[model samples]
Target: MTIPEPGGPDALLWSEVPDPVPGPGEVVVDVRATAVNRADLLQRQGHYPPPPGAPAYPGLECSGMIGAIGPGVAGWEVGQEVCALLAGGGYAERVAVPAGQLLPVPAGVDLVDAAALPEVACTVWSNVVRLARLAEGETLLVHGGGSGIGTFAVQLGVALGATVVVTARAAKHERLRELGAAHTIDYREQDFLEEVRRVTDGRGADVVLDIMGASYLSRNVAALAADGRLVVIGMQGGRKGELDLGELLAKRGTLAATALRSRPTGQKAEIVRGVQEQVWPLVEAGRVRPVVDRRLPITEAAQAHRLVESSDHLGKVLLTLG
Candidate 1:
């Protein structure tokens, strides 16, 4: 998928492109599947661009087999099954990726479904677990719990023994609860702050996994418990807002914002290795499952983008290659 020019979903064109060749310490993956993300949508709309030296396409992660390996690459060979966290270029039949960013598919995950794991797993684990330090017995509040990252966080938070609360549509509440959300707030019909307070008996969340950036800044602070951590990874709801420093200071709340892409290769590799060591086992044991909403052929990349923009799907939308 190539964007002729940044515009909308219609801007995506599925045309043949040059096959990627591996650079030193890199490998070429014969991409079997790639999943859609909000970053991809932003890139399609001209708001985001690939990092320096990364592919110019819009995808952020992919799963496939190693087709070729560059000199100095080790522990992986051609024909090995793997998925990778990419800065871009997953929207093609093949993509060149750093060797260290690659992860072997978990023991029980299907090849194509593995495409959904890399971005979300690394994202949630790095933010909620590493940054926020959400521990057992804490209460976590997740916004957009039906989203890809939200779904992953809800389950992982639960698996780690936290009482999870989520804000999503009423239709998605039952599924979110089944996935271990102790409380679900229908954002459309309820106030998330009130719901969080009610669920935790007047104590707010220990941590908040927030995607609506500036728009939710004030409320996120309001919903935090003392010493709470709020990690913002996306800005779907506009970019500027006023912060109540006094409020944040009173709560002793910590705020952080991060993006997986644009990080140095060494940082990405570290995150990948952590995911492999920590999250992969939970996946292999069937404690966490990939929540893919639907799959479309790569040629219909525009349709996939449209579906994601609609926000009607529960989990991930994937684009499959031949």
Candidate 2:
């Protein structure tokens, strides 16, 4: 298997390493496409090392056909089209994933496009549905509206009958509005808190999906309504800050922080099961679709690294094997 190295993108060499075989309860995929994510960037930077026993290759999720199943694997076949949440090894042409982590690609969507699904949808659904308990007819705020997770959040929040407010660049406002952002605040030109307050009639949002961590922390709390839940999925801005615990407690807000890549296999499998039951139907019915920013070859991972590092991509970016 030839895969990108962990440490700088410059160290991403295509070396022919040993191929992987599934252990009991595992399955291997013939990868068709893999999506680049912020975690992939951190892994390449050496700040985020794969967990002990996790594969060293960078990919966290992928879309592919099942090549083989290991002992004890069931309810799946050799020729299934699967979009998998991998425990690494996604950058390689062949990746071994736990059987329970594999989700069947929706019938009408292309497999390569399905590569864009697992991480973003799982992130949005897990944080919004599982953690925050977002309810219908409430207001939800999503930071980074043009991102893969944001796109999914907008659609999912809307499909569940929540009014959505998204922070985006002005260039993305129209697109976000079309995707069900009832209010779009261009972060470059306006304050998200003010716009959200105005849009929600000064009641604040019922839920907030935040990628900007400490930088948005106080402001996010300020933007939450009574008993609002704030789920923090990433700290793209900065990590440390002093919070007004008094204000948070007064508002009765709850904050939850989580990461998908570092989760225990059982926990991830449970998330996969929930999404399969609740979210996959939306995909099959075309109410939700993977938003692909672009696709490139896996061998050109050097270029792929540049694309993600630039932070200019609007949605999920994919890399395919030859």
Q: Give TM per candidate.
A: 0.99, 0.97
Question: In candidate 1, what are the lDDT values of residues 1-322, reduced to their tens digit?
Answer: 8998999899999888999999999999999999999999999999898889998898999999999999899999899999999999999999999998999999989999999999999999999988889999999999999999989999999989999999888999889999999999998989898888888888999999999999888999999999999999889887898899999999999999998999999999999999899899999998888899999999999899999998888889999998
Q: What is candidate 1's CA lDDT for residue 239?
A: 85
Compared with the true structure, model 2 gives a TM-score of: 0.97
Q: Which segments of candidate 2 are over 4 A away from where they belong? A: 1-8
Off by over 4 Å in 1: none
Q: Give the alpha carbon lDDT tens digit for every residue of 1-322 in model 2.
A: 2334456567777677678899999999999999988887888877788887888878889999999999999999998999999768888889889888999998789999999999888888899998899999899999998988899999999999999999988888888888888999989889999998898889999999999898999999999999999988889988886789999999999988898888889999999999999999998998888888799888788788888777677788899986
Residue 226 lDDT in candidate 2: 97
Candidate whose lDDT is highest: 1
RMSD of 1: 0.8
Q: What lDDT does the true structure give each of the candidates?
A: 0.93, 0.88
Model 2 scores worst on lDDT over the 10 consecutive residues at: 1-10
Question: Model 1 compared with the native: what TM-score?
Answer: 0.99
Where does the lowest 10-residue lDDT sum fall in candidate 1?
Answer: 193-202
The residue pairs in collision within model 2 are: none
